[model samples]
Target: MAPLRIQPMPTYMDIHEIPGGITADEVAKAHAHDAAVEGKYGVHYHKYWVNERAGKIFCLCEAPNAEAAMQVHREAHGQTAEKIIQVEPDVADLFLGGSEVNSAGAVLLPGGAADARDPGIRTVLFTDIVESTLLTQTLGDDAAMELLQIHDSVVRDALKALNGREVKHTGDGIMASFVSAAAAVRCAAQIQRGLAQRAGEQSNHPVRVRIGGAAGEPVEHGNDIFGSTVQLAARLCSHAEPEQIVVSSVVADLCIGKGLMFRPLGEVSLKGFDRPVHAHSVEWSA
Candidate 1:
């Protein structure tokens, strides 16, 4: 008879929403409670983020199932989570990055003082060279390579200025993550504008690109950042016109009062998503 295989428990990110607000100390006590009882349920509560001003707390844990994870909370402090989403541990580490955890298990900013908490929210951005294959076909290998270099230079420069981190290069595009949604939007705009100026100078290549951005936690379904947020950003990028910028509604909402302009694209159908996503077009020209 073949031996039975035991599957690994999944990692989950659970959100807790308090009415007024919550403090780090309060969450620390709650986390201590959870840790004391989690072993009984075969669950492990890892780290947590507390947005004191926003009255939100995000806890990362591993359990046999969502119910098992919640049961630990229910038995410990009676403060059930608002929602729990399974996430890919590797991808979460990639996007959210690692942080310093206090003895209480609350995540803190990487080099910041004890009070500076890391929110665990991130903005994901993608940039694709419009008609990259055709550009290569028409411009020849050497010229296409030159234009690609220009794209890399401009995007990396913008990322550096806006504090964005390049996750990976996608051959024809780039994927990046930002701690601030406003910074991500600004970075996208800077890239588009920079490319436009470069296009005018290098009229021969006239490279044009499209950008898309979305904001969300690190919850994901696959090894890669195929999380809904990342997927929406990629879909919006493909849906954009040449030299244009498109972003998800949450990105727009997060950029409110940041002096950016976005025209509503309404709800648009996107591949791999069950429902239509509301998108916005960022005005980056001039």
Candidate 2:
């Protein structure tokens, strides 16, 4: 037998079809799930399009291979995949590379006016209340909303402390942006620890929060993050345990020169994104 020849991971796309009549509420729920899984797996290029004409849902993602992408979809939402296709990242990479180059060429000093022509790579933080489903089930709907208001308030307070901007709320979840990867990770850990303290004080109803982050050039849209990087951050938070913070290799790369320590969790190929993205789950308070 000849020596084994290792093959390069084939870049591909995974298409999943969600059920028809997926309501706005369902889309919100599904999007949350998608974001969380994407974050956990580090797939930074995902686009969703609904096709009512064919009564099918379209999800375009970059992945190392069909198998890896399929695994992501299955593990993320337990959804059965419909189609998977091979792709050449070279073409898309050219476009992505150009964007990065343009961003680097621009000089945007902090607190100074800068053109919105570039998509500057930055860290994105996503935080959300944990066990929200059980809470709503136990507490009345109105009471649940009131509790969420308080939870949001606490989160906002901490975010403000860190000089972060809230991207938006996906129901109980909040997406935030930061200039520094270390700061974003630190802020996430802080929120988790602080929320845990608050939860410990509540004997009847403890509220926990899960946090995750990714650092990359997130497409900016007003105050919201609109790129695959942002989606990946939210996905990481979704898969995270209460008070746990998960980060991507992109974030890990940014903190290389910095002194922040990280515990590596090996590699995971997220849905729709080509190549395996190294992942790390930051050590937080037990």
User: Per-model C-alpha lDDT, please?
Assistant: 0.86, 0.61
Against the true structure, candidate 2 reaches a TM-score of 0.55
Top model by lDDT, which number? Answer: 1
Clashes of 1: 0
> Which digits, one per residue and each the tens of the lDDT, describe model 1 over residues 85-195?
888787667677766788889888654565688877788999999889998899899989999999999999999999888888999999998888889998999998899
lDDT of 2 by residue, 125-232 (tens): 887788888889989798789768767877788777876777668788787777667777777777777666776776566667778788753222222223567767
Q: Which runs of model 1 end up more than 4 angstroms from their true locations?
A: 1-12, 16-22, 37-44, 52-55, 61-75, 78-90, 109-116, 220-226
Worst 10 residues of 1 by lDDT: 217-226
